[model samples]
Target: MPQFSRHSRRGRILIAIGLGALLVGTSACTRIRTHQGYQVDKLLVDSVQPGIDNRASVEGTLGRPSFVSQFGEKDWYYVSRDMRALAFSSPKPVDQTILRVRFDPAGNVVAVDRMGLEKVANISPMGATTPTLGRHRSLFDEIFGNIGAVGAAGMGGGSGGGAGGGPNGS
Candidate 1:
């Protein structure tokens, strides 16, 4: 074999180190993360028996519901969701569950319903442009909209206290 120069060997080592570091950095940047919401324990939820468990017992078991019904106080909802996403990407829902517990007028649990991701609905907006009452102005209109609206002295009645001639000006 042929002997390699010290400088050439050092350069090759540096290049290998740089390539290794680049691979590590890129892999770290593209890492995916899993996020969870509302630690809803299935066992605890199951332990809550309808008609037997009241609002107090249910709350004690599965903790408070994520939110109550907007129309009435008889419905309680627990929302649990798992999201996964890569770096710099919007999180996508991997799993979701909505636990609905209906209470009777006497505050006793009447019904328990568990809804899974199958019930998830992806609602897209009707149009890309949102409906607005006023007219939409362009970038040029915005930048120059107030250009002529102001006077050379800045605020019209200002005593030449703008630009190069202000209270703190030279």
Candidate 2:
């Protein structure tokens, strides 16, 4: 019978641990890509004309204003917020703008200013919490479009509109 050395066993154990670590590390590696966002249209004094830029044009350009000046209607605001999942990451308003476009009685693109996030107040994590919005329609009821109906095994599958956008926006 052949006797194996203790050092050999230890070496085998070390090799197994190394291979396991390599496999685990390789499996964990993944790639996530971020696509470029659309152009952020904001008020630029030199570019935007006050009377030329109306509510429709403004909305068409920037989608929607984040906020409007409480003091003045002429002054519009655009604010954007983003929260990083990393621990202890400071909550930040990634984008903000004070659309300062002063009009001379007529609604023409007057002098405008594109402010940075500094214009808006930084929101702390402790601030207001977002509330959960319940589903508009139950899943099963949507597909079937039946009143107060539940599907097999409580699976909400139907043509009706429900929690999820089924065939319709329902």
Q: All candidates: CA RMSD in angstroms?
A: 12.0, 15.3
At residue 141, candidate 1 shows an lDDT of 90
Candidate 1 lDDT (Cα, 0 to 1): 0.84
> Could you say which candidate leads in lDDT?
1
Q: How does residue 90 of candidate 1 score in lDDT?
A: 77
lDDT of 2 by residue, 37-137 (tens): 33354343344565577655656665555566676566555443433323334344444435554544454445566666576665546647665698666
**Which tens-of-lDDT digit does each residue in 42-124 have in candidate 1?**
88888988879999998888887899999888999998888777778877788888999999999999999999889878877
Candidate 2 lDDT trough over 10 residues, lowest sum: 30-39
Model 1 — which ten-residue stretch has the worst lDDT?
Answer: 150-159
Candidate 2: stretches off by over 4 Å: 1-47, 81-85, 92-105, 120-170
Query: Which regions of candidate 1 deviate over 4 angstroms?
Result: 1-11, 34-36, 125-128, 131-170
